[model samples]
Target: MDPPPPPQPPQFSLIPPSQIPPPQQNSNPNIQPDSIPNWDQNPNLTHYLDLSVPKKRRRGRSQRNSALFRSPLTLNASSNNDLSSYAITSSSSSAAVAPPVSFSSIRNPPPSLTQSSSAYDFSDEIIMINKEPKTEAMIALSAGFPADSLSEEEIETGVIPVIGGIEQDKTPTEPSKPGVIIIGAGLAGLAAARQLMRFGFKVTVLEGRKRAGGRVYTKKMEVGSRVGAVAELGGSVLTGTLGNPLGIVARQLGDVLHKVRDKCPLYSVDGKPVNPDMDMKVESAFNRLLDKASRLRQLMGEVSVDVSLGAALETFRQVYKDAVNDEEMKLFNWHLANLEYANAGLISHLSLAFWDQDDPYDMGGDHCFLPGGNGKLVQALAENVPIFYEKTVHTIRYGSDGVQVIAGSQVFEGDMALCTVPLGVLKKGSIKFIPELPQRKLDGIRRLGFGLLNKLCHSCWWSPVDCFSGR
Candidate 1:
């Protein structure tokens, strides 16, 4: 028989890059509701305990060329933002001569014990979930958190969740702190939960969205003549696989990686591609400029312990002031914009160290998209994990033993808590914390900035290109 078909891609409604799903048509044909005869329906705590056998490491597999590129961007030549940090291209301007403006920028489950079988045990819980009462009682019973308020001073300070009464039952042997509360069901929070779960600790995740899977987004698109393909609108590319734990998880979950190309799209100011033959001189000059950038990078590295990318770049500009022609300078500057945007943030706020940390060369990784869009990875991760959706945290108070969280009048206590809130939410002070946070964490919070990225896809059923990256 011919090979079977894969499941239909999800009907992603709005793939939000804002740090955080849709219609359902049964894609499978011969599938019956009772196809899996022995699936479990109740909440089975035991299933979560099942662990897979660790894969043995090969002798010299070169660690699959980790996405981390210690090599410099000047060397990679592949101009696609995929290989750069933060996918920060374009907002960087392929237009070097153009003035700086603003710009924004998974799981698995096991078989054996199924959800149906657990239904008997969790029947009441299911009813409770659907009922949506003031979650205070559930949080009280599930986490032992408090319902107290916090001071404005505490709100201003960024602090990690403190340990208190919620930790009373917590043990060092456990993977997670018993009383820990994890808010937000996206990749960061989920990853924290997975790590904690490995230590055998129970976790509570409060998701503001009605669904799990935070920023990794996918949506239906009129991608050329193709009716549907999972196009990632947020958190689209994977970087630094060699060291990025997330990248590793992505591949294990079967995400697809698209190679980034160096041949940049030349535009005629109106954004249409310029004829290659006509643009050959400029393209070749762009290539020569790459050579100059490599030398500049080396010079900057030798200059000082503390220097910003812009400063170093300025120095480089001065060095080449009288060296290259004005036309060449325009092309050279444009390519630098491409390099800086790889991190996707304001140029003024960026630094050489940030680029070094993002390190796209040695740390430079091959770029690719998730096969079914990043949404697939998110769903796989959350398939069977416990997530309470549409639950926004309101107040937090810490006691001698544990931390308490208040969400819609419901209280939960946990030994430790992980709040993977977006920078925007935290800045707005939407959720309050008591006992005050330390100054250090708060500083990090204030200093760190979140970037915005947008993609507006259409039913371009008749486009010349196969896929669009908005280059």
Candidate 2:
């Protein structure tokens, strides 16, 4: 019978031979009975078969199914040793079947290890393969995985993955330069902005008023046929030409400066011209009294109680008052009023200790006036600088993270903030600080005095002869 069908190979099964069900007989006439192994004959034969040798290759339908469900054996030594240690146990089954392996399961192994037959022995290779795909955290935790292997959900939520108990931020660092917010578009603020911009910083200036120049205001006067002359309603004169900031700006703009002469024509309160000789004598006496007061302050040294400059000057004036006539005394009083005007405050409020402290730093040379008002200098400095006007910043919230300035309904954020607002504004509490200013600063602001100066510009057409003569 076809040479005894070449000894049909025995089928392997985990189940015992007695419990295994017999195979169904093939009904096809073309198939010979000798080709199929009879399970009834010698049932215990499969028990004695060697399992160490790999299963024989099959053909046709069985081969195709085996290829699809076959689990791959890792060629590592540890994996081979672990596989060899596994004990072969029999179950109530016809043939040995391997679990199906998926592509993802092979690529990303499970985190847990499989236990071998021996107690306390664990297999290094992950055998508990999941049917479903691996998750993002599992893939990231796997060794040799790329750093950017974050899931779509993690990326969208900006969640950084934790590896080995340490969280890592994979986002790239920002390359842009820092930004600065400057309050008040005054000269100080504008100058700082320009300098910062040159150094590659982004700057924004917030100004409360409609125009710049801060307290330096210039107004054009056109009063009936007088050639439109510009009047300085605020700061007008450049105190010194040598080393003066405004002087430098004037030179840059190619503008001319007018020097003011030290000539004063005194007039009595009764509208009578005073003798120039008497005017000179009183002025000298007043200056001598001021020098004497300064010397006295130096001699007295530091005192616990502070006295007003006016009080000290008055004390010195009594000694000199006996030598001058009443008209000359009136001229001296006028000089005192001029001194108050220069200080921009009443002599009663001026501090005796620090009233003339800044005199030594005064720029030497001629005191000059800019012809078109100092507003031109402001314009020159403000060129190309982005200034937001009427942005009255009412609140400032600053911290290590940066600063937030709230101007009306608009909010501005920057890496740093510069406050160039006048001390008067701070003292008035117009702009509220998130954390209130320090007690010391508040005390100083309260102690310091701010004075107001009012100017009245007159447009008069009269001849010098008529003006000087009692008109």
Candidate 3:
């Protein structure tokens, strides 16, 4: 008979409760709330986009199809709140919710490597003729297993013999809790989470809505391609370099691009064909309006107030009066609507400073989604991450020791947590934080305005070129 094989170290196990403490929130006046608009305060002008609504049934068939199967999926078009922004509130320790029941008592699975002595022995599948290195032995054992998800115990001791996939004896050294708690699951939150995750701290992302990818919705519809495709119902344009990490990641992992047509025929506000040359007049007038609005924002400097894009355009009416056909105003309105969606709100609400930071004019080529939509990037980010659908993180607590995160009454512990919630939620005082954040951080977020940028994704079929006023 063959001799018995060598023994391996203990396998990974969940963190014990004795080591964890009760939940708490650190809030005070020092952590002032953000002055930006809240989600509830935002408006929904895009109701016309939802075809399922009873009123939309009145539209013609072609218009319905065009809206439903719109070429550019509205995913990530930001059909979300326009009053989005982060805020930090000051408060003394508030009420602490009970810890998740299964948090501490959850049983850890038996060590995979510590099974019965007579169990099947792990065999090595050698690729090379003579693999003598112990590294090779370790690699052979680690096949088909996740390395990043391993426990701290496994990462440190390294002695645990690998079993089916994980090192049982090892446990992750819990991460530190963060000062600030963020809410929402938008691009901004994702970017912040990605950055903070790199640090040795934990983040709690409290998302009020059931689904993630806030405003960047990518729904799979059975249309477009043979197998059907994912379509966007929100913001569809991505311009500039740094402001568009999704564009880069898409090209790298998905090898996709927004294939914008060489030229989109100009249309009158009333949907009539128009000459692109005349668009120069439109662009010229629009430019001045933008410039004036930008200057207004700079002058205001603080405290957000609302402004209307339509009103701004009114000042330039006389400039195009000579070319004014009956449909000129309608054409102008349609163009303005598309631009409004581009910014997700009126230029008046848009922070010129933010725009400059996100995508400076003439800096790089503007980007759009693949025929499917920008949801591809969100799907890619979620591929390996351990995310729960419909899961909502409620409270976040961090201290000198490890981090604690509460989601839908379930508390999860980790060496470090990365809170990737949107700034809007943070501003609203939705989730509680332990150890009040420094005033500097609070002030930064306080001043950082987050206005809502909502979009409605649905479609309207082609109606008469002049539906309202007879042509």
Candidate 4:
């Protein structure tokens, strides 16, 4: 038997050298014979020696055992059955080398590795490695199995491993756009919803009332021969035309505006018209007093005790009371009532210093009335908006994840919530907040007052002459 080939020199490698073919010869004339040996053809030998070759291994569980003897730190299996196939040398030695193993492929291991019948399952072993603190040996073993290979349950529980002092995170694909919940489908809320929708956000508006226009109600009534006359119940006039948002919307809607004439006839409670000359004198005096109050406020700056506008006007009125009769005094009182009406607050409650703070930003130009009433503007804004009427949102719970609004029997959830409810509603504590509103906001809501005005529309057939003749 030729002395059994000298006992094969005690082959230390698991793979026999007889099975590994010789390095193929280069066909190109320019290639030197001394060039680096192509170890890809001899994977068994390369794996045994733990050689760092440029070429990658084939993709499959069959090739997993090819690197079984790569390092002592690497997990091992008792069975060598799977290793026998790779041990058999490649028949086509001149085949092109495979590409290098991608990081993604390493992260997402082959499915067959989990279904292996070996004594040791690499999937379980990888979980065990992740549980233990990262060490040099564990990292060396973890190189073959990445953290992403773990199941979703393990990943959610944070069983990922840290390699080279850097913890690897499974970066999932980005989620879809966020959705917003809007409370109170008022002008502010509707406007915000439209803006957010334009920016690719999903919006839902919840209105407590059956109709969208909060506090803006318009009704049709018969006036003399006219069948349908527009009667404004709230916010009748658009205060200004220039730089007014409502004016802009009106223009966009192609609606005509009737400019209110600057002619207002003053009458006493008894129906007798006041003398124009006396009205002008009282009005001029009232305006002078307001200008004087403004100058006094500028000189005083801030005061410890807040003074009401009524108190200042009353002091000036006392000086003028001696120069006027009861009728002129009534005109003066009427002017004060007008101021209260304009501010929607009593003169006694109006702050003397900060009451006119918003005056500088007041829109300029003629105050006009929309033909169909302000309700048309509300209808335009409500157009195409996803509004849930009569939602009656009562509770708002907000957190890091998102917001939850409890409206009547329904609970609405969204990525964020916008609260545009009226100040009166907030002050009344009609809606309950989960953690309660901030103290600062609560204080402001308490300090700020709200008022309402009732409009009574009367249709009269009598002319101006008939009214003066008591008809």
Top lDDT hit:
4
lDDT of each: 0.44, 0.52, 0.39, 0.54
Poorest 10 consecutive residues by lDDT, candidate 1: 50-59
| Tens digits of per-residue lDDT for model 4, 1-471 | 455542121111121223222224223233233332222333222211112221111111111222321211112222332111111111222222222333222222233322222321233333344454331122212233233233232222221223224543332233235889999877788767665664467789999999887776666555555534566776677665643566655655557777766767888778999899998888778877775455444333354026666766666555455226767877777777667656677777767666654442344456678876777888877876789998999999998989999998899999999999989899889999988889998999998876667566665444321111011
Higher-lDDT candidate of 1 and 3: 1
After superposition, the stretches of candidate 4 with alpha carbons farther than 4 Å from their true spots are 1-176, 222-227, 320-323, 458-471
Off by over 4 Å in 3: 1-214, 223-226, 240-243, 262-270, 274-278, 288-363, 398-403, 413-417, 434-471
The sequence of per-residue lDDT tens digits that candidate 2 reaches over residues 290-377 is: 6655544433334302556666666566645533556665666676667766666776766655665434224434567777677787
TM-score, each model? 0.54, 0.57, 0.44, 0.58
Candidate 2 collision pairs: 14-90, 14-91, 15-91
Error of 4 at 436 (Å): 0.3
Off by over 4 Å in 1: 1-177, 222-227, 240-247, 254-262, 272-307, 322-330, 349-355, 360-363, 460-471
The lowest-lDDT stretch of 10 consecutive residues in candidate 3 is 53-62
What's model 2's TM-score? 0.57
Specify the poorest-scoring 10-residue window by lDDT in model 2.
57-66
Tens digits of per-residue lDDT, candidate 1, 220-319, equal: 5754556454456667666434334445445444344555453556664567775665456544544443333333333323232244444544444444
Best candidate according to TM-score: 4
What RMSD, rounded to one decimal, does every model reach? 25.4, 45.0, 25.8, 37.5
